[model samples]
Target: MIISTKLTAERLEEIKNHPTSYDENSPKLTKAQIARLRPAHEAYWNVTPVKKTISIKIDADILAALQSGGKGYQTKINSILRKAITTGDY
Candidate 1:
C-alpha cells in the first residue's frame, strides 16, 4: 500500500539547495515523552502483511537450512518463500 513518487531531477536539485528553518519553540521529546508516545504509535504499525499458519512439505535440507538460523526461523522461511515467488526462483 506504500506508493512511492519519484521527484523530478530539477525539483530534487531545488530541494537539495534549499535552506532549512527550525522552530526554536518546538521542544525535543524527552525519554518520558517517548515512553508515552511509543505504545500508541506502535499500535497501528505494520497492520498489513497478515500471517497465517499451515502445514507444508519440504526437503529435510531446506528445513534444516531454515531451522539452523535459530530463533524466528519461520520468519526466515517465509522471507525465502516470498523472495523465491517474486524472483521466479521457486
Candidate 2:
C-alpha cells in the first residue's frame, strides 16, 4: 500500500494526541501480567553474534551520492544492505 505524505502527517498527529486522552483509571497490565509477558520481550532482544566483517570498494560517484544525502548515510547504507540481503537481490 502506498502511504501519502499528507495522511502520514495526519496519522502522526493523531498518535501524538492519543496520550492526552488517557484517564487515570485506564486499564493497565498488572505486575503478574507483565511477568508473564517478559519472556517474549526478552526473546526479541536475544541477538546472534556478528561472525565477520568485510571491506568493499565502491565507485567514487556512488560514495559521493550517499555522502551528499547528509547525516546517517552509513545507517542508510546498512538499511539498504539489509533489504538487499532479505530479498536475496545483492
Candidate 3:
C-alpha cells in the first residue's frame, strides 16, 4: 500500500527543512475520526521482538531468581542468552 512520488532535490530540501510546517495549523481530528483509525496490522508492532514466546521449563529456583530481577526479567533473560550465544558461553 505504499505510494512513491518523485520529488526534485529542491522539494526534498524543502521537506527536510520544514517537515512540521506542512500541516502546522491544520484542524485536529474529531474524536469519532480518531476512533476510526485502524489498529496495527503487524502483530510484531505490538511485541517486544527481542525473543519469541516458548514454553520451556526451568528449575523453580532459577525461574524465581530471574524473575526477581524485576519487571522485564524475560526480556533481560533473552538479552543475556543472546550475549551468551554470541560468546559461546553456554
Candidate 4:
C-alpha cells in the first residue's frame, strides 16, 4: 500500500532545508540477506492476466459462503476456479 500527503509550501521548504536524519546505529543487512533480495517484478509477476466477464449459476449456499468473507468475493471465486482448473480438482 502507498500513502501520500500534500505538504504546505512552508513545510516543503523546511524539508528541503533540513532533511530528516537516519539512525547510524540501526541494524544493517548481511551479505547473504542482500543476495536473497530480488527485484519486485521478479518476485511478483508484473503481468496482468486477461479477464473475461461471464455468468455461471452456483449453489446459493456456496455463493453465500463466498460473499460472507465480504468485499472481493468475486476475486475469491475467481481464485477458487483458477485453482480447480490448474489442479483438475473441482
Say which prediction, candidate 1 or candidate 4, comes out ahead on lDDT: 4
lDDT of each: 0.75, 0.72, 0.72, 0.78
**Residue lDDT tens for model 3, 27-63:** 5666567656556785655765554678888899988
Winner on TM-score (2 vs 3) = 3
Top model number, lDDT: 4
TM-score of 1: 0.43
List the pairs of residues colliding in candidate 1: none
Candidate 3, superposed: residue stretches over 4 Å from native? 1-50
Kindly give the number of clashing pairs for every candidate: 0, 0, 0, 0
What TM-score does each of the candidates earn?
0.43, 0.41, 0.42, 0.46
Q: Could you arrange the candidates by TM-score from highest to lowest?
A: 4, 1, 3, 2
Better of 1 and 2 by TM-score: 1
Report the lDDT tens digits of candidate 4 across residue range 1-90.
643367978767767899545576755666566657567777475568899889899999999999999999999999998777655466
Candidate 2: which stretches are off by over 4 Å?
1-54
The Cα error of candidate 3 at residue 8, in Å, is 57
Using TM-score as the measure, the top candidate is 4
Better of 1 and 3 by TM-score: 1
